[model samples]
Target: MAQSVLHRDPRVDFFRGAAFIIILIAHIPSNWVAQWIPARFGFSDATEMFVFMSGFAAGIAFGGTYRTAGFWLGTARIYFRAWQVYVANLLLFFFVLVLMLAANAWLYADTDYVTQLALNYFLDDTGRALLGLFSMTYVPNFFDILPMYIVVLLMVPVFMALSRIHPLAGYAGCLVLYAANYVFIFELPAEVSPDRDFRAWFFNPFAWQLLFFTGFAMSMGYLKLPRFRWWLAALCLALIAVGVVYSRYGLWSWSDTLSDLRGQLVDLRCQNWRGDGADRCYFWTKSNLDVVRILHFLAIAYLVVWALKGRERVLTMGWAQPILQCGRQSLPVFMFSMILSRVYNVLMDQTERTTWEEIAFNVVAVANLIAIAYLLGWLKSNPWRPHKPARTPAPEAQGQAQGGARWGNAVPAPGSAE
Candidate 1:
């Protein structure tokens, strides 16, 4: 990978930051704002965007290290990041659990918040659930993203090694794994149940890795995106329009009709499969990263690139700064948003679900995300480091320095002569 190819692009940050906001909205149940998110508009959503951007950023951040340093060093860095994400996941789960417990205790609400999150497994069998949680077995739906991410990060070195043999080799490996996901149905058990009724990780890393490595390959210069063209943009627009029409959230009057069509397709296609076939449309299976989602995301991503190509300056404008900053510190921002969404869900539950209340609550939630992004950025910058003022030379020293300059023996100030 060429170092030059790995330079930062502002558009990556812009889209990624925007996706974080969308994910926040989508996670909070009954938020009307979620209905208007891109997922509602199309097959793909922020989860795809998040995973793809993670791969792209990982390439930019670690690709050069693999090239300049040895393979072991690069692999070490990747695992260190995975460890960080693992810790964040644990922290988030416990914090949210505690929050819900406290709310349930004090609010006198009739909601069993733990059961709402499908965490009764933990309550019913703490020992088994704790073992499952740490071992990445009992991955609840809401908490699956980070576990998927951690597993993906661990696979980076494997792909990096394949890429060393040839770029095609790396992508071929990715495709094989992706296809094998369907053939083998490889997935982590999401429940710690003793019976045969077992659940699996929502975002299946084996299947989803195709998108991640696609972004990775592009970032590492193994794959190159075609420059924006008018005809291509038109095609992308047409695809997006089709996605909107076909999406479950589209066409209020056709919702039931579309639902039936999807159900028919799932029954026709998935029921006969040798492995476990989920009772839903395989074409829109978020867990499987179906082709429909892949194509939809590609179309949306290309059109976005076309829209931003000559107008890159817009990302640096006043209103875009908060989003850009959130992208820059995405891990912290995403973690904070996850924690914040729980509070928003609790508050929204108490409200009448009016338009004004929804708008107000969502606005406050976004504001909180932006504030945390900036705060985390500042903290990561090591702002508490002591600063030393430059010392002024004494009168005699100044005179000697002046004499040395005249006599061609003066040393230049640091970076002054560059």
Candidate 2:
């Protein structure tokens, strides 16, 4: 019922589905295929896609509620989802903690992924860490994104309220907040433990909110995708090519034919993109949501839309259907991918793998993920799934129910009798 609330959009689902798999591959640092993922060629990666898609989804799903139900009720529904996300995140925190501990004992004891995830505080100061987790202040590595989403969703009512008076009012605020964050390089201060020390949130809400609201505005018709002019198409293709090369060749562990050329671009990007603790090879930082990253995502999106403009059948094809299904079941599939990535990371750390081997592993991982998502999608579509019954309308109405009598006088049809 949750996923069914919105009018299904296949394109968004396909992109979301693809983003989850790409994210899984990217998260496993030990995998050679990580380099071949989209981030290397483009400034943006799966995070941008996921965030933007979520925003668009919110606009459609919650926006429908605003128009059909009441504004406050729709906003409340969105917040209800935020709570669901938070609860899921809490489960994930404990789940990852247990997985890491078991993995440490069972496989790579020396790896200590618990520390990498920032969960070691729980090991040393359980009481303090517990407080932080409950308060949404103690976010571990992959868990950080949920807190950001929860905070942003809390603002949807305010954003929608402001938009009613003036279209740009809420969006302008999003820009100013983003600019302030970039200039200050700030994150929501997070308490990792009971200690006085504070840590900045991994995904800066101020910066990320801009993208979310942008997607919302676009979906709601406050903004629209720029017209696909010839120049625009060219621009998108060129940028997509740049991203492809980096992902295909930029050094992670192996070198491809284009590595030399990609190496030069990375060097130029480092000087052009100034920052502290910078990694020259990575054109943009995931947390910062750099201009390049933003543009790259836009470019990729344009290309997808442009290419698939009239190609409706492509998504429905047997091979692509799994991805579309996964995209539709994004919340479950994302959680699945995250856990799977961690397990793969442990395996990669313990043994050596070649680029081809890593690619093969991803191939297998994807097949399994698709199977799981397909099954979940099937479950979601079950005829017996719980849902609210349709409300009966008032007796007085202009049109009859294809019968001679009005609603108040109508008798039940022969086969329809209860």
Candidate 3:
């Protein structure tokens, strides 16, 4: 048997990096950039791509360790990663809170930053709110994504263990958990509230795990992607077109007829899933990873995968370098972007927000994000560490190397390990 080797996939990083940019733009309130994000064109947005790519990365990072190094070591690695994400969440929350407070105190803005973010829970009951924040029970909407991500990472170990028993077992578990979300109405509490307002996290881990693990399985070779065919491509494109027409942010919102048709179809789907009085469900819901959203995203993913197949070299081009770099350092970039979005929102509120100002703001914001990503990448590389120069071979050693090469020994020369 041969040991498996892992190679870096630019496709994963490219898409993930692109997702970070979209997320950053979308988070900022009333940013003109938001109107042009991919969410405006389809039912799904960058969130799906981000989560799926994360799962693929995890599979490459940890799944192989589980198979070769055994389950315990892999589980430990997953725990460490989850801890890192958890700490990042805490830092991001505190940093954003400080930013909001500063904006409130220093800027004469009409919007109450604290109230806008629904951070009153902390001010009203500091002790309880602290407990909930630490326990992940008092998640504000802005900070909910990381909590959901942490929970999903923690689930990887369970699936990895199940996979050892039977390849399909873990997949079954994913489906069961996804189904349980709708059937049993299972979701983690996001806030401690007397009323039902904002009860659960904006993204439900159980429902969303399906997308993550699908990527995981595909990356780990437990599942295979469908073969690309002309018919399949056409089907996916058609589905995406339907999504565009059905999407409120898309063509459907422009005309009453399309809007009514979408509503009726959505209501029918909702009734089929949850009985007649299902709170009048819409075509897309972010919190539970609605089926329509899942389908639309999958269709897009299939098409994109095929369209970009064997063209991964494009990701290495100069134009794509910024996105590639951001994807390589996605975690730090994400945390930075989260805080940066708040800063942008505050600045926008303080400024005139005219056409020219909005254009300048978006351009500067993107430049800042790219700059931070490159800075983080450099820091993470630890350039401050002392470099050890390559050792020069002695005359005898050089002679031996020459002799080995003459005899076809296949010995690698100094500084030529690769």
**Top-lDDT structure, candidate number:** 3
Clash pairs of candidate 3?
none
- Write the residue-wise lDDT of candidate 2 on 178-241 in tens digits: 7776555666667665455766777878788888888777666667667669998898888777
The CA lDDT of each predicted structure is 0.76, 0.70, 0.77
**Candidate 3 RMSD to the real structure:** 7.9
Per-residue CA lDDT of model 1 for 1-418, tens digit only, reads: 1221222356667777898898888888878888788888887889889888777767666665576566898888888888989999999999999998877887755667888898877888899999999999888888999999999889999998998899768888999999888776787898887963878899899999999988777766777777768898888888798778777754634778767876675567556455455543452478999877888898888877667766777877998999987887878788888888888988887878798898899999999999998988788767789866745532223322221122122222211110
Off by over 4 Å in 1: 1-8, 250-284, 386-418
Best by TM-score: 3
Model 2 earns a TM-score of 0.79
Cα lDDT over the full model 2: 0.70
| Model 3 spans with C-alpha error above 4 angstroms | 1-7, 195-198, 253-260, 272-284, 388-418
Q: Which is the winner by TM-score between candidate 1 and candidate 3?
A: 3
lDDT of 3 by residue, 98-159 (tens): 88999999999999999989897798888988998999999999998889999999999999
Cα RMSD to the true fold for all candidates: 10.1, 8.8, 7.9
